[model samples]
Target chain A: MANVFHQRLDELDELLVDMARRVGEAIEHASAALLAIDTEAAAAIVAADEDLNALQFRVDDRIVELMTRYEPVATDLRFILAAVRISVDLERMGDLAKHVAKSVLLRAPAPAIPDSLREDFAGMGQAAVRISEKLVRVLAERDQMEATQLGLDDDVLDALQQRVHDQIPDLGYGPQVAVDAALLARFFERFGDHAVRISHQVVYLVTGDVHLDRS
Target chain B: MANVFHQRLDELDELLVDMARRVGEAIEHASAALLAIDTEAAAAIVAADEDLNALQFRVDDRIVELMTRYEPVATDLRFILAAVRISVDLERMGDLAKHVAKSVLLRAPAPAIPDSLREDFAGMGQAAVRISEKLVRVLAERDQMEATQLGLDDDVLDALQQRVHDQIPDLGYGPQVAVDAALLARFFERFGDHAVRISHQVVYLVTGDVHLDRS
Candidate 1:
């Protein structure tokens, strides 16, 4: 019975890691579409988000089944609770990626960002992608060190957001463009935050320490 | 055993309703600070958010304890899961309010929003508050009808967001103000979205139908 339970837990981890990887791909594709003004890639990213959402539902249902079947207590119970929370954060990260893709779709023929701000957005996208890659490994390995490092990676995204704000005044774009760019930057920044949040849940699962950063 | 479990469930519902009420107050205070440009009120709202976070932690801890103690299955387990999800949404609504308060603080002595878009924001705030109030009733009474109404209330917020976008071009404000106003509007719209999410969870709890609503 214990072996079967451990096997089920392993399967759950695999599903979550799969979700993390797809979220990274979504961010990368959305970023590419934004830079190239490719509406097709953006539309594909939007459609792919449903798969992430569906995976989250499957994770959640499996979790409920595990709880009902195992009646896990103490550390096992804590792990299950954290799994549900982590899935929520991962699902939200996918939604943020979809928001970025939709921004690309909205300005298909025209770039959503001005050329002056293009480099900053590229940097933002790269930061988000790197953080998500780290997230996939962290979820799969449950490495506390990597989980701690995810917070630092999120700082890079925050700095990029500040850079976008600093450059907005001089970007020479109209108010409409400025607003769109700011929102786009915010969506990426939020994506990084959710990644950090998932890592925090992992840390809690591993160490029983709840560091709920109120961001 | 069933009686005690039902009692604990009732207690959990009260805590969630309490959270809903406090979140409504936070949004109201944040909105007032934005319109009045009152830095003190904004500061108060930011500080008070910690209390909401604390309440969420307390609720979460109790949920884990309840699950462990009762090992609830079937409907009882589903109810517990929904409680945790609702607490998450309510906690996030409080954070959104804090974001609004911080925006007010960042532009203290100068209104974060220009006079031209003030009424749209006012309408947004009122819509958020009404939705929150309905959320409190829906949680306390498990009213699926009121829960369904929340999606419609959120539409009012979406329309106001559109109005802000429509008016931004001619507002004569610089790019910075336009971005600020736009992000602020997005923040409120997200707050409404979270409310709708909580309502959806309530509907699922009452009817066992999952309306994920990929917005």
Candidate 2:
């Protein structure tokens, strides 16, 4: 029975990892759509969000069922709990993508963002995507070192966000343009934070320490 | 042993309820400070956020300890898990209040928000605060009815927020005023959503059903 339960737990983790990958892809696509003003890609991201939400609900249900049936203890319990936290984080990342897509759809057919603003947004997006990719790698391998590095990546994203803000006032754009650029920067920054949070959960799963320095 | 564990769990619940009340009060105070443009009150809210964060961490630590020692199952396990979720939601609410207070501080001692915008902000704040207060009460009493009602309150807050946005274009305010007001409305809407999430967690704790109709 124990062996069978362990196999099932592993399967659940695999499923969650797959869902996380899909969420990451959605975020990447949404960020590209925002930068390029591609309404089609933005729409695709929006449509994919329901799938992410469905996966979240399914994973949550499975966790509750496993807890009821197997009565997992110690590390197994922690793994399931960590999966729950990561699922919520992934779902929110999906929401963030949808928010970005919505912003793109709202502001499309208008003037393109200034070159400086676009470069800042693209850099932020790339940093956030890299963090998400690394986070998944950490989870897959239980690499605490990689997880620890996510904290530093988060700081980088924060600094980039501050730079974006500083440029907003002098971007020589109208009010709406500035607001859109700021909102886009914010979405990318939050995506990085959520990725870092997922990495933190991974470290907690492996080491049972919740407050590992991400920096 | 079971009885003793159960009694201790009850004490934990009471502690959580008290912490939630403090968080709700802090949110209300912060909102009032924003509306009044009272920098001192806003600063107080910012300082008090540390208390909320400390309480959240303490509650989380206690829950973790309890899970380790008791290995609770069935309803007891569900209760502890719900407590963890509610703690996170409450902490985020504290953070939201801090965001509002920071906005107030940033925009203070210059042009006060006009009366129309102030009324909209007050309405939004009142809706969010009322929902949060009701959520805490429902959690303390396990009142599923009140918990269900919070969903409607959240919708009302969202509607008011929409009205604030629609009026933004007509306000003829400067660019900064419009942008700041829009962000503030967004904050209140998000606060309402968090309150609804807490209520949903409460209903789940009571009934073991994730989809409770708040309508």
Candidate 3:
């Protein structure tokens, strides 16, 4: 019975890990669509979000079921709770990607952001996606070191976001353009922060410690 | 033994209710300070935030302890989870209030906002605070009707925020002032949305239904 229960738990873990990976892919694809102004890719990211949301619901159900049926204790209980919270963060990340895609569709044909700003946005997007990927791996392997490293990477994204803000006026764009740039920068910064949150959850899962130099 | 456990749970609920009231009061006081540009009031609000944060930490710890100690089931489990989430929302509302106070301090003695736009901003702040207060009451009584009404009130705040946004450029402020006004509008809109979220949680707690009329 214990072996069977362990197998079931592993299966649930696999499902959640796949969902997190897909969320990261959606974020990256949506960023690409925004940069290329590709309506098709943007639409695809938007449509894919329903699947992510459904997966989140299913994962949550599974976690609750495990808690009730298996009565997991100690580390097992922590893992299940973390899984539920991480699923929420992942679902929100997917929603944020869809929001970015919608913004892309709103400004179709005419580029609201210039190439210089676009470079910073893309860099921030890639960093965010990388953090998400690293988070899944850390959770799957219970890797404390990689999880800690992901937290550090967030500072890089924050610095880049600050530079993007500083460059907004120098971009010499109109009011609407400047506003869009500022909002987009904010989105990227928030995305990075959410990624760090996931990484923090991973560290908690492994070490049973919630505080990790929040500075 | 069961009676003792029930009594403890009731105490936890009372503490949570108290925290919710404190959070609402903090937002209300902070908003008034911002509109009046009262630095002393803002400072007091900022100082009071430490108490809110300390209460939040205590509440979180108590919840975790209760969950681990009693291992509540079904509705009890759901209620505890919802309480945890609502506490987080309340903490965030407190932080938003602090941000508003910081903005007031940054602007100092003079009214940073123009007279023409003052009414719209005051309207938005008042709406946010009122909605927050309603949500706290809904949580205290678990009132479905009050929760739904608060959701509708949030819509009014949203519309007022839109008006503030439209009036931003016409206020004849410099670029920096325009940006600050835009961010201020956004902060109030977010505070309103947090109130809506609290209402949704209340509906869930009362009906065990997560799907609320978010429109």
> Higher-TM-score candidate among 1 and 2?
1
lDDT scores in order = 0.89, 0.76, 0.73
Cα deviation at B17, candidate 2, in Å, is: 1.7
- Error (Å) of candidate 3 at residue B125 is 1.0
Model 1 agreement with the true structure over A140-212: per-residue lDDT tens digits: 9998888778888799889989999988878787899999989999999999888888888888888888887
Candidate 3 deviant stretches above 4 angstroms: A212-215, B107-114, B169-171, B212-215
TM-score of each: 0.98, 0.90, 0.90
Please provide, for model 3 over A22-49, each residue's C-alpha lDDT reduced to its tens digit, 9 standing for 90 to 100.
8789888888887899888888988998
Q: Among these predicted structures, which one has the highest lDDT?
A: 1
The per-prediction tally of clashing pairs is: 0, 1, 0
DockQ of each: 0.73, 0.32, 0.32
Number of the top candidate by DockQ? Answer: 1
Scanning candidate 1 chain A in windows of ten residues, the lowest lDDT window is: A206-215
Query: Of the native A-B interface contacts, what share survives in model 3?
Result: 0.00
lDDT of 3 at B211: 66
TM-score of model number 1: 0.98
